[model samples]
Target chain A: MNLAAHLVMLPVLLPLVAAALMLPLGERRRPLKVMLNLASTLALVAVAVALAMRAGTGAVDVYRLGDWPAPFAIVLVADRLAALMLLATSVLAFCSLLFSLARWHRVGVHFHPLFQFLLMGLNGAFLTGDLFNLFVFFEVLLVASYGLALHGSGSRRVQAGMHYIAVNLAASLLFLLGVSLIYGVAGTLNMADLALRIPAIAPADRPLLEAGAALLGTAFLTKAAAWPLGFWLEDTYAAASAPVAALFAIMSKLGVYAIARVWLLLFGVAAGPSAGLGADWLLAAGIATLVFGMLGVLAAQEMARLAANSVLVSSGLLIAMIAVGNAEVIGAAFYYLVVSTFALGAFFLLVELADRGRSAAADILAVTREAFGEDEDEADDGEVGVAIPATMALLGLAFLACALLLAGLPPLAGFIGKFMLLDALFAALTPAAGLAPAVAWLLLALLLLSSFATLIAMSRAGLNRFWAPLEPRVPRVRIIEMVPVALLLAACAVLTVAAGPALDYAGAAARALIAPQDYVEGVLPPPATPEVAP
Target chain B: MELVLTIAIGVLTGSGIWLLLRPRTFQVIIGLSLLSYAVNLFIFAMGRLAVDVAPVLEDGTGNSDPLPQALVLTAIVIGFATTALFLVVLLANRGFSGTDHVDGREPPP
Candidate 1:
């Protein structure tokens, strides 16, 4: 076996081993835990980058556990789509861990190990080429997230964590049912093999397969936080500690990635009538989700809640794009995914530090003043301490950058991502068989409306927090905390500056996703000649 | 035998769903446990229930598919772990909020 074939497993293995190593170390060994986690995260990032470069060349790498063959054994495949997700996740993880190191890690026991375990689960979910393993990984990540969500042990965190746990547990049950149905119908848990077997399935079994697929879609949508199924998301994410919330921004996208990969690969244009069967419902639910999120963003009383709503909007757009089933939209959606997730992740990290020094009364005061009209009393509370202009200015600037990214304003990657998506929508209309012009126009309008809503909400919140400046005690944000936020925002800046190559990579990934022939081949190669000469 | 399994799964899932809809956190956790049991059994039945047969292939006639059994085992273990974790979180939540209401408040008592 090629040594590089082993690289396919590194993303999952690196985090798992590091987390295991950290488990036995006492909480007193904080420095060692941080160092190990940082190293593990950084190494995973390097591996993901390498994998992305390799996948860009259109090669799919597959690793078989214990040298087992694909169909009957565990397989992990790294295609362009998987590699891209891994890269994005590790980048977010590295920043989140760095930010947590500032003070949040000390508030809770086992924060570091749980974070690493979450990464392991994420990487495993991204890489595993089988359905059963996907369930295992989903549970792994959820369990880790449950621990992290309750890290601070506040009423709100625990309450929200309980809701998050309960909802996901239900989804897990649905996941099992879905998996069992698929297995019963196809007798295979390997995704690629199932894809091959699905079309040949007896017509009588088609309904069961469809039911299973629909149930599976429900599970993913619940995680993706689509409306009706996503009531748990905004509050749960908002209540999490800053770094944990930041880490969770990417967690939501795991569902987006899974849906796109599985729906396209198994029930793609290749599946005949089922080819695009779910597209319309996806579009409907996505739009509803977007509208619901916009309302939440507008109504959110706190910055954390607003950020959580924006995460919903981001996922809604990606889900809508996936439902479009066009390579063009998928490409733009992939780009959008990277930019928005980073922006939202950064915003989540920034929320705690930004809110720390401000009086909760002042926050309400800021809101009411805006509602009633800016008046002299808006600056009611006189300062008792010297305000740090430089730190306040730095946070304001960071907030502005995140706002621009979230609201799809000019010159940032968010704008570029939205532009690409709009461009794709319009470009699709040029072709006769593309999404109908009216539907395209409607989607275009909806996207614009969501962005506009985000801008309005963010503008009010940003001004209220930074500009109002009344009753402000300068938040004693640490250099460690500030550094991670800056790094995350800088990463977004890099995405904006590097949009050309980024778009190309996303395009390649989208194309590969739309046409997963190579992926299927990599996962399920013709079984090697019966080695034992049976 | 298959009909019996079907009815068992139906009862478990129906009861689970009913419990899941309740506003109490403890009930929801129990709902999840019951639902997982239903799912585990469903996964087991997917391989086609068999009597007096080995899971592993021993002769030309073959045996029940063991893959579903294996999958169900893993699922059961995971379900156990999550239930324990959920119970911990619920305890913490009740400690903080002073109620087991799913919304974290008492019901006008």
Candidate 2:
């Protein structure tokens, strides 16, 4: 009845209602659609901020839909970590939506409604206290994403959309099977109830439950773009339109977030044999993903693919740290998740605009045309600039900021994040742990080497685009496009300046997540937890 | 009855995975639909099969576990929407590239 009680559902409901309101409206009413989207996203941001502040106070806000009791009816929870994820999503969604207003909103039908629905789905996933709804929300977001990915009518976009759809459809199947397996075994889908039930599960059922969990992890890893299952990532992200690509950056982290929640809550120390069952797999997969991502980054011919590959590296680092199941490491990974997603999203938007003025055969076309005494190149509306244009200058600065953030350079949030993570892991790594020390060193080396590789790839890209423009032409960028990129980069700057509070928030959120009792108790009312034995 | 359902699911999944590895777009779509069927049935059976029983819960009367059924219904609708979208994308790509291959090339066929 109170505002805080209602606040738990506002984030999910706001977007759903707005999207529904926009659905019947014709695309010809573009201005109205844009206004509705911007207003809703801004409102969502405000609501998320309030929820996040409330969460920071260490109180878990749970709202049962229809006021039904937990473990039976659906509940939406806003714990510290969930609120943080919601806040990050709304922030990125706001910026990306603003950037799309430059022109992409009109490129396809139902863009506004789909965007809203995507937001609704994302918010619901983060807030839901049950696994069934998580699957439901994953489908919702993926369907919207499929629409967004193929928004512009291009053969390339459609090609990539097919692969994206196929892979996700398969992943969704896996998700369903996993959820069903868990439900069949545990007879419940509510996460808190599962936590209560897991400890008493029969030893005969343990392997089945673990199998279900592994299948679920596979689904998340596919979405997260882990090592072997991440083959579709670079091409799909590269093929997506700019703003859509930017928003898709957070899509990978959704996987990691789900893993963070489930691993800590349902399978933490309370789950007996299931405690930390798949932690080793997460570590191995994480390192392999990082290594493969490093190769992808270096081998990328286009800057767009490089941006995509770097996303894999970010996921790899987060997944590896998250696997260690340390409070401090999870906290550092949380901070790194926010920073790297921001940087990658900004870089995707920039690459789209910056790539406009260049032709496919840039160097060959320039030299051959000049040798043939043909000025056909200059006729393409781009003028060689004597002085750098403001657009290029702004783009260069944003790219530099993105590069620094991506490479974990100092005086930025990325550096601070990597430093925090290493500091935490260094304390855990020892020769006595046998395989862990080698993994620790490998992780540390990969972190630094990936950063170095990013520097090289990004500088090569930077030089190609800005520094030594082979054909220096001012890229036609509007104010709307530039504002979002600058705003996102400014956020990275603010994160750097506000690292103390940010780190404290992340630390508290991670502590809450690592200590599962707080979350389990928060969602469920005080009652007898029935113990079952086979 | 459980044995029959389990074998059916296994056969569907094995064949579905086999077809998923093919490079043709239509074949891949078929594989996906097949997999979706398997998963939907799997979700349905999560409720523990109740033949000739009312699905709705009534006072003291036996009913099937309806949650998995609800989830499967949602998955079915979503699966339909995606199948249509994939078909559209595939057609558009075929028109543009003059190929049915998933990668948009005929591969020397």
Docking class of 1: high
Give residue A316's error in model 2 in angstroms: 0.9
Q: On residues B28-68, what C-alpha lDDT tens digit does candidate 2 reach at each position?
A: 98999889999988988888987877889788878888788
Provide the lDDT at A520 for model 2.
80
DockQ of each: 0.91, 0.85
Tell me the TM-score of model 2.
Answer: 0.93
Residue A394 CA displacement from its true place in model 1, Å:
0.6
Query: Candidate 1 chain A, which ten residues in sequence have the lowest lDDT sum?
Result: A377-386
Choose the strongest candidate by lDDT: 1
Positional deviation of residue A236's Cα in model 1 after best superposition, in angstroms: 1.0
RMSD of each: 6.0, 4.9
